[model samples]
Target chain A: MQEIEELAARLRAFAEARDWEQFHTPKNLAMALAGETGELLAEFQWLTPEESATIMESPAGPRVRAELADVFSYLIRLADVLGVDLPQAAHAKIDENERRYDADAYRGSARKAPPLSGA
Target chain B: MQEIEELAARLRAFAEARDWEQFHTPKNLAMALAGETGELLAEFQWLTPEESATIMESPAGPRVRAELADVFSYLIRLADVLGVDLPQAAHAKIDENERRYDADAYRGSARKAPPLSGA
Candidate 1:
């Protein structure tokens, strides 16, 4: 996670150097993250399912990557503002998903998984 | 990145165990990533700017985290299918941005910076 931390530190420094912290509020970061995510999705909006698979190999790859990186940067910034350790939180949530998305019943189903037996 | 790699491995194994690999293509993962990102954004859709900042402390935090994890999982899956090294790609993008988004010229601006002066 050194790379993740380093990139985030660099972003923080960039914002701090510019005195942009006031605008670096979680609200703004989340909105920015959403906007970037929307941009990322837009790159695929007109693609066929097969074409979507090769987007990274297509002419749109650079733009797509730029949008993706933007999404990640905002996500990291949002997590930092909220005091969440992103990788740690991600690990915990994925662990829970392992239980919730058990393969025994969910395999081959494209539908949303129902909740487990108990709350 | 060990953690990211571990989660990807586990996800792969889960899919393999269920013979879901046929459905785990890059196209599907990209769409799923976009869908989860939209879900993450929806948590803050109606919040005022002030309210957006405290979402983690609000009742919606868990849902937000769950949606974030989903975004991450699908992103990882998509990159894996596309043969992209996500961390490296992100690092490279940030470095380029360090040059493109120079704080000296961009500070205090809420607007998009115009393209750099040269080709």
Candidate 2:
């Protein structure tokens, strides 16, 4: 938790020192996050499911990690700008999911939390 | 941090309880994360920049949060499957970015982490 807070502070300091907040409007930050997420997916796009899992053993490993880093960087920045406490928000989400993804109900499915058909 | 880890453990328990590890492979988890990210972006696809920021005030707010939760859910699962420590990885990325995004050199820009032109 301290690490996340500290990292956000450092990033905020960097942004403030240069006054980049004007450009870092919530929309722009969300756009950046979405773009990075796309980049992260691109690194896995052509690979077979097995290949994607083992990507770290291939030449694309570093590329994948770098993209993941980008995704995370933007995630933190977006939360900062929106005043969202990520850890708390994330916890609440999981708590919600606990009921949504009930082990007794959705245990064998790979489908996410979408409502069941005819439910 | 505890919450994140605890949520991961709970998710794992849910998966294990139903023997869904076969579908919880790293590749599959990453794919799910990517798909959710795309869904998140779609929520903002038609909005003007101003509209995007204030989406929470619009009817799309809950949808946006749900999508974000899905993104985070898969992200945590991906890291868990890969044996990656997300907090550490994120910290290292910020440190690396400190050099890459020198406020003195690259302020007022939103070009992401690409290399300089002709550098």
Candidate 3:
């Protein structure tokens, strides 16, 4: 958790050093995340079926990791500036899920959907 | 965007209906999310090579999507409860990525790692 915070701080410092805060508006950040995602996807774009799986840890792994990091960094930044506790929020959502996907219905079944109500 | 909010509202309603708020504490929710994640991974367990990639939209696809949604829903719920604007946070992260993975170093290259500094 502290690592998440430290990572966010490094990103902030990086942004400050570049004097790029003016472009850090929410809309721009979202668009950038989308674009980087595309870049991540691009790594897999045109690879043969075998290539796609093997691509990681070749030249592709680093790009994928970087893109993911990019996605995470600003997410943390926005959370920080907005005053959100990410772990706490992450925990709350899971509780709702247990009820939604009750274990009895899904535990041993290969099926993903819950059983139809009362059937 | 509005759809995201509406979905969050419905989840809250569902939570309220169950009177399960006592168990909705942060720790429980996280454990539930992790458990659901394991269920998702279970779908892929023991599948042949061909089975893994072609699994989507098959019996496996729905399970995968459901698990993904499970992961996402709580993520969104946490954001909603914390009043953090998700899209906004998502956007900001992208801006930071552009500089980190400059196009010149990676464009059209299979290599994912940026060039060695000053080379």
* Model number with the top TM-score: 1
Per-residue lDDT of B60-86 in model 2, one digit per residue for the tens? 877766666667667777777766666
**Per-residue alpha-carbon lDDT of model 3 for B24-76, expressed as tens digits?**
43333333444443454566566654454456546655544444455445544
Per-residue CA lDDT of model 1 for B2-116, tens digit only, reads 6557766866776676666777666556566766767777787788878877888889988777666666666666667666676676667667766877777787765655221
Clashing pairs in 3: A29-B91, A29-B92, A30-B91, A33-B94, A74-B93, A95-B29, B57-B61
Candidate 3 CAPRI category = incorrect
Check candidate 2 and list the clashing pairs: none
Winner on TM-score between 1 and 3 is 1
Interface RMSD over true interface Cα atoms for each candidate: 4.4, 4.1, 15.5
Q: In model 2 chain B, which range of ten residues has the least summed lDDT?
A: B110-119
For candidate 3 chain A, the 10 contiguous residues with the lowest summed lDDT are: A110-119
Off by over 4 Å in 2: A111-119, B1-3, B111-119
Q: Chain B of model 3: TM-score? A: 0.71
| Cα-based RMSD of candidate 3 | 15.7
Q: Candidate 1 — which residues are off by over 4 angstroms?
A: A112-119, B112-119
Model 2, span A14-76: residue lDDT tens? 677655776766676767777777777787777887887778889987777776766767777
- Point out the higher-scoring one by DockQ: 2 or 3: 2
Rank order (by lDDT, best first): 1, 2, 3
For each candidate, what is chain B's TM-score?
Answer: 0.89, 0.88, 0.71
In order, the Cα lDDT scores of the candidates are 0.67, 0.67, 0.47
